[model samples]
Target: MSEGVVARLRQRLRHQADLGEVLAGGWTGLGPSELAVRPVYLEGSGTVPLGELFDLRGEPAGRIRFEGDLARADRLAAGLAEGEVIVEGSVGAQAGLGMAGGTLRIQGSAGPLAGAAGPAARRGMTGGELIIRGSAGAETGARMRRGLLAIGGQAEAYAGHAMIAGTILIFGDAGPDVGLWSKRGSVVALGAIEIPATYRYACTYRPAHLGLTLTRLRARYGLPVKKRHFAGRYHRYSGDLADLGKGEILEWTAE
Candidate 1:
């Protein structure tokens, strides 16, 4: 593969910036100069060209990298339909909102609704992979229709709220009321979690799919996968009985 583009932040942001347009579809063919001219919205200052905030480098090869402390950058990779995006630091809310394809990898924490649908949209991420190496805020994958969401660290409340169909893997502690109102999907909890009352315990078994998914995560992302995780059994709970009741929560049991 050719060398992908890199955009390094010029300095710490003074106000939150909306970077939803930076790496959206059709960016893979654009050169560094063409891509840098795209617009971004700032909280108090309105719109400004991306070049003003980030120093663009390299050429687009179906991949992009952002190096910075973008804690105030919101919607960093929203509406992404293809290619690969890598963020080297923490990001603000709605990091991968409405993504359809490709991969969005964040090396640090993410704010609320990281992979969820926008207020006006009908669904969240429909396809692709969202990998967060650090913690994630509340409603991480709310209203998702499809895709894979993996969090390496803790996930706050409502991690997979109202999920339509998808898979969410949380490696650390999952906050209260997880998978609430989900219609069809899977929430895999590797650590502590409190299953909601709407869900009923089903059985403890070693799912064949679990091993396959865990193996891929370990090989591709370098996640901390242990022998226990590979051989351990999971307690399955089916729920959101209030909804379609097809959704499930799989809590890992120690060997």
Candidate 2:
């Protein structure tokens, strides 16, 4: 699989850049020139062409890769509905907000709300996969309606807060209030997790799903999957009973 278009940072951005809907639907068919003309909202400056920020290269294809320091670039892949998008380094807030389909892979930490909904929107990420290979900020998957968010490092507070449905798999320690008020969803914690009082201890067993999910992560995504992860027993806790009580937290226990 080739990296369709490579967008390299032209300069160190001082302000937050909102690449909203720039790589959404119909982007895979666009060339570098076409995609560069899309709108990107800057913090102090209003709307500006994407070409003004990044140097776009490569032919039109089904994937795109962004390089350089984008720590101040927010909404990098917002509203993405198809194809693949890759970020070489850390991203600012709302990395994959409201994404409906396709894959968004971040090789570094995410700011916040990786697959969560916007403030005004009721739903987030109807479908898709978001892979954050580093630590994530608060509310990474808050109000997520559907999709998969795999965090390779520690997640801050409210990692999966208020998730309606979907999966949030954290390979490292999870922060406080995880899965808080989540009606339905799965928060798979491979490390230590903060279980709220609203959650009730369920059982300790090996879930069948973890085996398959881990295999794919190791084979396909090349995540650091240990043999103990598949052989370990998990402590299941059903939580956010304060809401509908359908969500659960699967914390990997001793091997």
Q: Where in model 2 is the C-alpha error above 4 Å?
A: none
- Among residues 3 or more apart in sequence or in different chains, the pairs in candidate 1 whose N, CA or C atoms overlap within 3 Å are none
Query: Against the true structure, what is each candidate's TM-score?
Result: 0.98, 0.97
Question: Per-residue lDDT for 99-186 in model 1, tens only?
Answer: 9988899999999998899999979999999999999999999999999999999999999999999999999999999999999999
- Model 1 residue 16 distance off true place after TM-score fit, in angstroms: 0.5
RMSD of each: 0.9, 1.0
In the predicted model 2, the residue pairs found to clash are none
Backbone clash numbers for all candidates listed: 0, 0
lDDT of each: 0.92, 0.90
